[model samples]
Target: MNLLHIDSSILGDHSVSRKVSAAAVVAIVAANPGVKVTYRDLDAAPAPHQSGALLAARLLDPGARSADQARDITEADAVLDEFLAADIVVIGAPMYNFGIPSTLKSWIDHLAIAGKTFSYSEAGVQGLAGGKRLILASSRGGFYGADSPMAAVQHQESYLRDFFRFIGIPDVEVVSAEGVNYGPDHKQKALDGAVAEAANLGRALQAA
Candidate 1:
C-alpha cells in the first residue's frame, strides 16, 4: 500500500499535531506490512500559493513557460500527483486562527484541479478522487467540540472534512488532541486520548 504522510506544523518538536501524526504513522506501519510511506513536511517545504500569473502559465505550452513558471508548475504537479497516488493519506493539521495552517491549504490547492480531482457535469459536480482512506491528526489549543462553547467558531476540522468530501472522500478519520494549550495536565490528557485513538485506527485498518 502507498501511504502519503503530510505534516504542516511549524512548531516542530513542540507540536502536538506532529507527535500525534507520527504516532499514527508508526502504528499504521507496524500493523500493515510492506506499506510504502512518503512523508512531506509542509512547514519546512511549503506549497506555493496559487496566483494569477501561475494560473496563466498552465494555459501556455511547456516550451513557452519561463524558467520560474516551469519550476512552479512542476512543484504543483508533483504535489497533485502525490495525492493521486496515495492509498492512505495521513495529515497533521494544527488549528491556526480558528482554521488550518496556510501551508496545508496551499498544498490542497493543487489537489483540487478541475479534471484531475473533480469535474463539473450536467448532473452537477462529480469528484474523481475516491476509494482512498484519509486520517487527520488535528491539534487544537482549545475545546471546539459540539458541546464546547467555541464550537461555532471552529473552521479547522469542519473545513477539512468538507474539502475532502468535495473530492469524493467523505470518510475521514480524525484523531484530535484538543485543549493542548489549556494546561500541562489538559495537554497530556488530550494527547493521550489522540494517540490511543490513532492506535485504534491503525488496528482497525489492519483488520480491514
Candidate 2:
C-alpha cells in the first residue's frame, strides 16, 4: 500500500501535530509491514499559490505554454499524481487563526483540479477519488469541538472535513489535540491523548 504523509507545521520540533503525525505513521508501518510511505513537509517546501499565469497555462495547449508556466503546471500535475496514487493519506494540520495553514491550503489547491479529482455531469458532481482513506492529525490552541463555546468559529477541522467530502472522501478520521495552550499540564495531557488516538487509528487502518 502507498501512504502519503504530509506535515504542514512550521514549528518543526515544537509542533504537536508533527509529533502525533509521526507516531501515526510509525504505528501504520508497524501494523502493516512493507507499506510504502511518502512524506511531504509543506513548511520545508511549500507549494506555490495559484496565480493567473498558472491558470492560463492550464487552459492553454501544451505547446503554447511559456517555459515558466509549463514548469509550474508540471509541478502541480506531480502533486495531483502523488495524491491520486496514494491509497491512504495522512495530514498534520495546525490551526492558525482558526484556519489551516496557508502552505497546506496551497497544496490542496494543487490537488483540486476539476477534471482530475472531480467532474460535473448530468448527475451533478462526481468525485473520482472516492476510495482513498484520509487521516488528519490536528492541533489547536483552544477547544473547538461541538461542545465547545467556540465551536461556531472553528474552521480548521470543519474546512478540512468539507474539502475531503467534496472530493468524495466523506469518512475522514481526525485525531485532534485541543487546548494545548491552556497550560503546561493541559498541553501534556492533550498531546498524550492525541498520540494514543493516532496509534489506535493507525491500527484500525491496518485492520481495515
Candidate 3:
C-alpha cells in the first residue's frame, strides 16, 4: 500500500497537530508493514497557486500550451497523480482564523481540476477520485462539534467534505482537536480526546 502524508502546520516543533499526524502515520505504517510513505510538507515546500496562464493551458491542448505554461500544468498534474496513486491519505491541517491554511487550499486548488478530479455530467458533477480513504487531522482553538454552541460556525470540516465528495472521495474520516488555545485544562482535555481517537482509528485502519 502507498500512503501520502501531508502536513500544513507552520508551528514546527510546537505543533500538536503534527504530533498527532505523526502518531497516526506510525499507526498506519505499523499496521501495514510494507506501506510506502510519501511526505509533503506544505509549509516547507509550498505548491504554486494556479494563475490565469495555467488556466489557459488547461483549457487548451498540449500542442497549444506554451513551454512555460506546459511546465506549470505538468507540475500540478504530477501532484494530482501522486494524490490519485495513494491508497490512503493522511493530512494535518490546523485551523487559521476559522479556515484552513492558504497553503493547503492552494494544494487543493491544484488537484481539483475539471476532467481530472471531477467532471460535469448530465446527472451532475461526477467525481473521478474514488475508492480511497482520506483521514484528516484538524486542530482548532474552539469547539465546533454538535454539542458546542459554535457548531454552526464550522465550515472547515464541511467544506473539506464537500470538496472531497465533489471529487468522488466520500469515505472521509475526520479527527478534530479543538479548544487548544482555550487553556491548559481545556487543551489537555481536547488533546487527550484526540490522542485516543487517533489511536483507535489507527488500529482500525491497520486491521483493515
Candidate 4:
C-alpha cells in the first residue's frame, strides 16, 4: 500500500500533532508490512500559496510560462500527483487561531484541481479521488468539540472534514489533542490521550 504522510506543524519537535501523526504512520506500517510511506513536512517545505501569477501560469500554456511561474506550476502538479497516488493519507494539522495552518491550506489548494480530484457533471459535482482512507492528527490549544463553549468557532476540523468530503472523501478519521494550551497538566493529559488513540488505531489497522 502507498501511504502519504504530511506534517504541517511549524513547532517541529514540540508539536503534538507531529508525534501523533508519526505514531499513526508507524502503526500503519506495522499493520501492513512493507507499506510504502512518503513523508512531507510542510513546515520544512511548504507549497506556494495561490496567487494571481500562479493562477495565470496554470491557465497559460506551459511554453508561455515564465521561469518562476513554470517552477510553481510544476511543484503544484507534483503535490497533486503525490496525493492522487496515495492509498492512505495521514495529515498532521495543528489549529492556528481557530483555523488550520496556512501551509496546510496551501497544500490543499494544490491538490484540489479541476478535472483531477473533482469535476463538474450533469449530476452536479463528481469526486474523482475516492476509495482512499484519510486520517488527521489534529492539535488544538482549546476545546472545540460539540460540547465545548467554542464549538461554534471551531473551523479547524470542521473545515477539513468539509474539504475532504467535497473532494469525495467522506470517511475521514481524526485523532485530536485539544486544550493543550489550557495548562501544563491539561497539555500533558491531552497529549497522552491523543497518543494512546493514535497507537490504538494503528494496532487496529494492523489487526485488520
Candidate 5:
C-alpha cells in the first residue's frame, strides 16, 4: 500500500498535529511492512496558488495554451496525480484562527479539478475519486465540541470533511488533539488520547 502524508503546520517542530501525524504514519508502516510512504510538507514546499495567467489558460482551449501556461497547469496536475495514486492519505491539519491553514487549502483547490476528481449531474455533484482512505490528524488550541459555545466557529474539521466527501473519499477519519491552549495538563491528555486512537485506526487499516 502507498500512503501519502501531508503536513501543513507553520509551527514546524512545535506543531502538535505534526507529532500525531508522524505517530500515525509510524503505526501504519509498522502494521504493513514495506508500505511505501510519500511525504509532502506543505509549509516547507507550498503548492503554488493559481495565478491569473494560469486561470486564463484554463479558460482557453487546451491546444491554445502557451508553453508557460501549460507548464504551470502541469505542476498542479502532478500534485493531483499523486493524490489519486495513494491508497491512504494522512494529513496534518492544525487549526489556524478557527480554520485550516492556507497551504492546505491551496492543495485542496488543486485536487478539486472538474471532470478529473468530480462532476456535476442531475442528482447533484458526483465524486469520481472514491474508495481511498482519508485520515485527518488535526489539532486545535481550544475545545469546540458539540456542546461548546465555539462549536459553530470551528471550520477546519467540517470544511475538510466536506471537501473529502465532495471528491468521493467517503472513508474519512479524524483524530483531533484539541485544547492545547488549555495548558500542559490538557495538552498531554489530548495527545495521549489521539495517539491511542491513531494506533487503533492503523490496525483497522492493516486488517482491511
Candidate 6:
C-alpha cells in the first residue's frame, strides 16, 4: 500500500507532533513490510496560501502560465494527486493558537477540489474520495478534550476531522499527545500514551 506521511510542525526537532508522527510511521512500516512511504514536511517546504492569482493560473492555458504560476499550480496538482493515490495517509498536526498551521491548511485546500474530491447537488453533498485511511498525529500544549472546559475554544483536531469528512473520508483516526507544555511529567505521559496508541493503530493496518 502507498502511505503518505506529512509533518506540519515548524518546531523542528523539538516538535512533539513530529515525534509522535514518526513513531506512527515506524510502527506502520514495521507491521506492513514493503509499504511505499512518501513524506512531506510542510514547514520545510510549504504550499503557497490559496489566492485569486492561483485560480487565474488554473484557468489559463498551461502554455500561457508564467514560470511562477506554473510552479505553484504544479505543486497544487501534485498535492492533490498524492492524496488521491495514497491508500493510507498520516499527518502531524500540532495546535497553534487553537488552530492548525497555515501551511497545513494550504495543503488541504489543494485536496478539496470540487468534482475531484466532492460533489454537491439537490441531493446534498457527496464525497468522491472515499475508502482511504486517514490518521492524524495531533499535539497540543493545553487540554481540550471533549469534556474539558476549553473544548469550545479548540479548533485544531475538530476542524481537521470535519474537513476530511467533507472530502469523503468518514473515519478519521487520531493519536493525540496533548498537554506537552504543561510540564515534563505531562509531556512524557502524553507521549507514552500516544505512542502506544499509534502502535496499536499500525498493527490494525497490518491486519487490514
- Scored by lDDT, model 2 comes in at 0.91
- Local accuracy of candidate 2 as per-residue lDDT tens digits, 66-116: 888888788777788889999989999999999999999999998887888
The alpha-carbon root-mean-square deviation between model 1 and the true structure, to one decimal in Å, is 1.3
> lDDT (CA) for every model shown?
0.92, 0.91, 0.84, 0.90, 0.89, 0.92
- The Cα RMSD of model 4 versus the native structure comes to 1.6
TM-score of each: 0.96, 0.94, 0.89, 0.94, 0.91, 0.97
**Residue-by-residue lDDT tens digits, candidate 1, 107-141:** 99999989999999999988889999999999999
lDDT of 4 by residue, 1-208 (tens): 7899999999999999999999898888988997889898999999888888788778898888889898888888889989999988999999998899999999999888889999998999888889888999999998899998899999999999999998999989999999899999999999999988987887676422
Per-structure clash totals for the candidates: 0, 0, 0, 1, 0, 0
lDDT of 6 by residue, 130-187 (tens): 9998999999999999999999989999999999999899899999998999999999
- Tens-place lDDT per residue, model 5, 1-208, is 8899999999998889998888888899999988899999999988878668777788888899888788778877878988998989999999999899999998898999889899999999999999788889999999987789999999999999999999898767999999988989999999889988887887678835
Report the CA-based lDDT of candidate 5 relative to the real structure: 0.89
Name the regions of candidate 3 deviating beyond 4 angstroms: 56-71
lDDT (Cα, 0-100) at 162 in candidate 5: 92
lDDT of 3 by residue, 1-208 (tens): 8898989999997787787778788888888888989999999987767778667778998898888888777778877888989888888988887678898998899788789889997899999989788888889988788788988878777788899999999978988898899989988888788877876787678534
Q: lDDT of model 3 at residue 156?
A: 78
Where does the lowest 10-residue lDDT sum fall in candidate 3?
A: 199-208
- Candidate 4 shows a clash count of 1
| Residue 150 miss distance in model 2 (angstroms) | 0.4
Could you tell which candidate, 1 or 3, scores higher by TM-score? Answer: 1
Among all windows of 10 consecutive residues in model 1, the one with the lowest summed lDDT is: 199-208
Specify the poorest-scoring 10-residue window by lDDT in model 2.
199-208
